[model samples]
Target chain A: MKTKFTRPERRLLAASCAVPITAALCTNAGAMHIMEGFLPQGHAIAWGAVCLPFVVWGLIAMRKIVAQHRKAVLLLAMMGAYAFVLSALKRPSVTGSSSHPTGTGLGAVLFGPAPMAVLGMIVLLFQAILLAHGGLTTLGANTFSMAIAGPFVSFGVYRLCRKLKVNRLVSVGIACALGDLFTYCITAAQLALAHPGEQGVLASMAEFLGVFALTQIPLAIVEGILSAIVLMMLESFAKPELREIGFLQKEVVKA
Target chain B: MSKKQVVTILILVLLCAAILIFPLMTIRDSEFGGADGQAEEVIAQIDPDYTPWAENILEPPGGETESLLFCLQTALGAIVIGFGFGYLVARKKYRAEEAV
Candidate 1:
């Protein structure tokens, strides 16, 4: 088999390979977002039901992207892998919550939040079934928090930053960081609702948020920076593909 | 380096430093845990009678082995997905060129 890759393509491949290895080295073993069977059956079912519509919409959006731009098929898959690897790289934080980059921000920015719905769900499923990181029953709750909520925040923040005419890389960083923080907030809310203290759901939510903030804030900043770096690499090496996927405007690519 | 490159580097360094320093300064002895475990603990504290409605289908033998399996799974998934996407994209690019 004669496979000739362009210089940029080769570099992209090398970078992609290096990312997971380095991330693995940096990771620590810890519990993730919501463990298996953590949520009550009603909450889990309700959350899963909530995610169904988004997942369906995501499937439609992904299909359209694939049909319109054949080149994007691979990028979508790579985005899924990137999210998996990044989320798995857990850094111990001052708070009990082990911290890691959500990695949804980049995908949401590149592919839009809809496609991320599908990608995130798949990643969660793999984590649950293969690594035992999450549980099948709690899949819905995890998916709702990490996949659905995180991506939407990321996409929204990116759009908002662009509207404000922020620096592209800085915008990406902020969006990713905000998205990470938002995911934890939602997770806290979910946990509080499921198991409200004597003080009530509002009080419990506040407690969870406070506990998470000690770790999540710094983690979010790290995630934002990492996502910006990844985006910069893509802009440099995968400009053509980014243009094809409509992530980079033609004028910007030309410049 | 370009201004953008310099800014990017600076941000990365500052964030890395903050992540490392904050933990050392505030809570040097805190046992880092996952949100899930912490949530579970809080739930227990809040309502001792609360019982989990579900259980994991399988539990890993130990924490070290569990981490090993997770690392393996993630690495394998990354390679397969990455290669598959790369192949598809390369094929599309090649086919387009061949037609032209």
Candidate 2:
């Protein structure tokens, strides 16, 4: 209700409708934010249903976090802000198109995927309302891919990497980059599933994956480096905050 | 920042810049469109009659407004992140001075 397209935007939306059957002929090369009214009603509702539980869990986790450490509120806001700033930028890709970074990885690594589900959802909601980039109808599907699935993957990878005794920064970097890639992968799978066409889901998935692979790989690397830099900055200036979230060891804290 | 941290961050910055710039240099006059539109096209191709059953509630009047909205989103996010970092740095300094 809060987000819709203007007439001119609808026309531009229609203008983009006249696209090549294959991705190669896409003249309006753009980022991967699913636009308004793109997903069918059933798919939209199903995705929304899938996201609801995660989002609810995120809110509960957020409450527990605040109860544990009041200062974590700032870190939480920072993570949400981090996600928005990164996601908003449409970086150029080798495919000669652009797509955004999910930006949820850092938060997932720091605070776990649950809170990020809430933060990422807020960012997606804002993008839908203000930018008309992603639509409300497809919000569930988009949120599931970017927020729920991606953050879970990021958090899991971060834990696994740390368990494997990889360097902290390197682990976080890998986790974040993989999270971004995973978001796009889920998006492709979701789209392919909803529109299997004549060739079926597997073939459609391959086609969708091909569309995103070249562009996303480089973007993922960029995301990893950027996330690592942010982690370093936080380490230098925000030790107490990091400690609050259990990201920094007790030895790292100033006496 | 320590020299090592500074150098590392600088190298990372350069790496990100190069990665983004490479695409622009190689692809002359490419539209660099969003992947979402391509997916939409694929959906349409797979099923020509699949009309989107829903519509966005609010669309910017034109392209300029859309750009403006996007800038606004980034600006808001940047401000919050900046404030968060600034607050943390100042708090550290305050604690140090208190100890002294």
Candidate 3:
């Protein structure tokens, strides 16, 4: 078995993690678009209230994953931190809806969903405490939509692709698009569930989906291509190490 | 199975259950609480001209008090469905590897 990441590549991975964290902290919508006061105080409080155990459970899970993949954990944590900060940054809209990236799919595909949930809770807590982007009540709802759902979808797609023997780039791109779309779909569902009386929930959801598709689709494609590029580069440049991490197929490499 | 494989599988299953089930167990009932449902009632009580189209979109039907039982029931159904799909994929992957 060989290692995957070259020394420089390891540094790059580490850097990728840190970059998102800083971006998340600085930009309200670094990856997710959260509008102003979209979730009510009561809603935020309710979700935030549910977020408590999730945070605790996430911390426990993170500790376990870190024991096995210290560097990966650090990088993933940074990404989660970045997501948190960005989630806190709010944009005002006439539509009275705030949206944010459900990074769960991306995170789950990379690091698995359990730790991603922890990462999301941390990010949400930070955003609520420091930036006040979202309310304390709505943390659970946000976590469920973004952190939990996103990653699980991505992971599922990736595994299915691997089994199907699809081209690596195609697999990643498809996963990215689906993952992002699912996040939005889940958010729409949540909104619907949260406020069924809103006769326009379906219409607004459709409208939001239409508006979001304009940018998100392309963004998903870009992200997918980038991830595939990085992973493929790793396959050639750092296959031996990545193989050890169970990301690459041992059979693919001609011994 | 190797220890690593066993550990990985165990964790994977646990995470899947958490992602698919926890939401159902802990999900709040009144997400639509105090927003649209009440607004509609108020509109109906007051304006009488309000159609469903103009009513606030965030509130629930029958008032702000959400049916926690309903959310949990629906969540349970969703989890079962999600798990079935996940299992199908996992089984497919396993079979493919066996063939190869």
Better-scoring candidate (TM-score), 2 or 3: 2
Candidate 1 lDDT over B1-100, as tens digits, reads: 2588768677787877688567767776666667666767887888788886666666777888789877975796579656864654465566665322
Ranking by TM-score: 2, 1, 3
Q: How big is the RMSD of model 1?
A: 11.3
DockQ of 2: 0.60
Ranking by DockQ: 2, 1, 3
In candidate 2, what are the lDDT values of residues A1-255, reduced to their tens digit? Answer: 011345664554344333322323322211125666776666676677666656666766787778777988898898999999998898899998888898999999988898888898888888887777788877878888888888999989987887787888999999999999999898888878878889999999888887765579999999999999999998888777777777776324521
Rank by lDDT (best first): 2, 1, 3
Please report the candidate that would top DockQ against the real structure: 2
Better of 1 and 3 by lDDT: 1
User: Tell me, what's the RMSD of every candidate?
Assistant: 11.3, 10.7, 18.4
Interface RMSD of each: 3.6, 1.2, 17.2
Which tens-of-lDDT digit does each residue in A163-253 have in candidate 3?
Answer: 7888765676567557766765655555444444445567645544544443344334434543444344333333333443445553366
The predicted structure with the larger lDDT, 1 or 2, is 2
Model 1: per-residue Cα lDDT over A27-100, one tens digit each: 21111277776777666766776666566667667767777778777677778877887788777676645766
